[model samples]
Target chain A: MTRPDRAAIIGIGYSDISRNSGTGPGTLIARAARAAILDSGVAKEDIDGVVGVYGSDSPTVWPGYVVDSLGLPNVTWWDTAQPPSIVGLSSAAQAVLAGNCEYAVFYHGKYRWGSTSIASKGDPLRESPAHEMDPTFSNPLVSHAGSLNWAARVMRHHMDRHGSTREDFGKIAINNRTHALTNPRALFRTPIKMGDYLAAPMIDEPMSLLDMDAPVDGAMAVVVTSLERALDGPHTPVVIEAFGSGLPIGSEGNLWPEADGLAARRAVASLFGRTDYSPTDMDLAYPYDGFTILTMLWLEALFTEEGGGPELLRDAWSEDEQVLKLFGRMPMCTSGGNLSEGRATQGFGSVLEAVQQLRGTAGDRQIGGSLNTAVITNGMAATNRSTILSVS
Target chain B: MAHTRRNYDTQPYWEGCDQRELRIARCADCHTWIHFPRGVCPNCWSDDVRHEAVAGDGQVVTFSRPRVPDGAPPMVTALVALDAADGVRVLGRLEGAEPDAIRVGMPVSLDWHEEDGQLVPQFVPSGGAPA
Candidate 1:
């Protein structure tokens, strides 16, 4: 691969988050794009590229719709990536680095609580494994097992293989809720103790209600520009130091039953191998927490120096605040994560929060000291992408 | 029809379920088993893939009984790793035992259950057919 020109996120913006946006998807997309463009202090005409995440409910060609709505000049480069906002972000960065475009804006918009539930009303299942697992399928056991059930099966296997308990999972939920208390944007600001986590209604056995991420209607956007241009921009530029995306060793034939935290280790190796920094260098890290088990899996995968296991997770949640905030130790999910902060646009929520921390704009939830670098994992399973970012 | 949305690749798999036989794609080149019914062999990337019948006996890798509303009784839902098809796990209902009695690695044989006007693949204790 040719060495691409360096790129950095110059600005990040988000719409008012809530259970219901009470607006159309197009409105949300336009609102977020405008906010990001304004925040970057870059002219709208300069945004030559517009990339977005395309889910079933989203338009087949999102950039065309967004550009028209925002009244921006015809972008030289534009495309929509399916799911896993990482693909969209990577596309935008590639356009910028290749000089196809100067300023690029990547936005994710979803209406989970709108009048029409997007999951039920979106495009029909088309050639995806997730479709075969639907309840109407001839497989009764998995018919009922949606993503939650699959994650539960993985969690059970993790317990059987590595001696992780339900309480160990509970500790992760508790820690996320604890962190959410300071985040006003968080949906579940009310404190949840170990009792609450254990006693909460079970969605899938081994995965209680608390372990799942609450879906909300919201949008988030990030502006990517050349590193040289970012230096002249408004906020601290979170430079993309290194990135890698791929499937893990065990994710091949089946998804959940045989799945393990090692699914992304290969990608993790490539990510850390390319960068000068190790996992120890990150002052903050955001592991994809679509499910709490996912967060634990990412923590174990990237932080192998500290030994990747559930025991480490249990200790991290149990440790004192000073130790939690220490450089080399547990610096994960500081924005309360998906579990508490509301699952805002899938992977973009975590990336948005990491950028905030690196820019010293995280407000009440900011980590102390000179925060230089952060690591973030976007997507899951075969579509995973891990990125390292820093303020240089 | 139990499933009205199946495409060409998946329709036959569901049809095999109706016949009370467990069929999975096998690589004609390497004999590697593929679950979830795909076009090519994941192991070898071989295009010589054909759906073949197998002894549907497998061990329960993991099981769950989600507390949700449905017509069927609270049956043990398990991810079964087939004996004939190593590393190929399929999700099916575990029958002929209490939900709480099921354990990981326990032997289970292929079976079928009818619900929502569809015949679905299920598993029962290997000792005998599901009663």
Candidate 2:
């Protein structure tokens, strides 16, 4: 099949990524939406669509609230999506392509609260209801205890199956931290060695604190419009060449599937089938780094042979530069990713960084040559979304 | 707090736990085993799903020892792939083994413990408990 009508990401915006933003979710998202509209050079009255995603634990900030707060008088289409903001991006893009709306603002806001955020634990207002359990926690008997438990299990499984080591996982953390040193928005910028990662406190066996994404209070938004309309805007447009979303065939009730990387491989197949560009054609990649193991899995799914992901990751690390450059040229997650950029849930940070790289506005973290193609993969095994963007 | 609300679909599995039996949902039509019992068979869309006891003989697919707050001992949790129940995998606490002794693909057998006045299924090393 030929490529579908392209949707372009013309503008990107962000609020402060901090442990404590001292504000509500609505305010954070509104700030991001307003900045995105202004950055796109699209008049507020011309924005006819709004799309957003928020964690269930986060305070409710619906799309209608964003439209109201931004005072966008012409919101003909609006919707909210589940976690992993890539779904929201897909929704907004489809809406714009279908002529339901012209310029749509897709926003994602992450609030620090409850068990995830140490800073918000003490605040009474941030406390989620005592009985409000995440759906994963609903069935304690079957569900993996939490994200950490499932992720650690996956890590151990990878190690056992492929003979990969903790050092492999450490390379990903170190590579992300190295890139974060240049990112002003990253939560952790200090350069770390393999020893630092090994010496860190173990939250789960075989996985240290650094292996997990730092939870923070922040928001990010992007403006999506047709490729034709986006070319007339102020900034260079990052065309959405192809988008694919899918789950593993038999993944019913299974979070950590025995066949690891099944979902990612499925997503990659679906994405490549829709676009003319293969994995090698992409100059940059932003694989989700919610957990270090996930990045390893995604890299394997996208580029390397099965069980060869860690080797690729190990080879990608530049010992001299202290960053990951795929094939000694292309960089991954120059924005520090969720690992250091603070987890802006739904892979919003990855998408934002990809857009900035394509626009040639990444500032100090920008790579050497002209970047024309990027592949971004988000979410976990249960639901995965992959998008290919290029500057055409 | 434990989930006090009664769920009709999974009530039989809980009842089996009370009797120290590991029960899983098996579709009467497709014979597919469903964990965390559901109302319909995902494989065949049959409503004739019923709870049945399994041999509960399995091996560890993977395991993790997570540090609990309050300075308690680290908890060993694992996903056990059942030998009899083709595609079903169950998550539960793995008892009677030090964190270092646990390994992927270790043989384990079904066990039980009492939590919140409810009998919960756990796993212990096969043939015997760890010394």
Best by TM-score: 2
lDDT of 1 by residue, B23-52 (tens): 786779988775555443444445466788
Runs of candidate 2 with Cα error greater than 4 angstroms are: A1-133, A136-138, A143-148, A250-255, B4-6
Docking class of 1: incorrect
| Candidate that scores best on DockQ | 1
Give the per-residue lDDT of model 1 (tens digit) for A1-392. 34556989997877666654443344456667777887999876677677888765442324544554454553445556887778888888886785545688998866542224555334332322232133112232346332235777777776777777777777677777777788776788887777887899887787778888887988878888899999998888889887754333334223454433554555566678667788777878777777777776777777753225566765565444521332335467777788876777576667878898889998988888888888888656534667888986
**TM of each candidate vs. truth:** 0.72, 0.75
Which residue runs of candidate 1 sit more than 4 Å off their true CA positions? A1-148, A248-256, A305-307, A319-329, B2-4, B43-46, B70-72, B128-131
lDDT of each: 0.66, 0.73
Give candidate 2's whole-model lDDT: 0.73
State what share of the real interface contacts each candidate retains: 0.22, 0.25
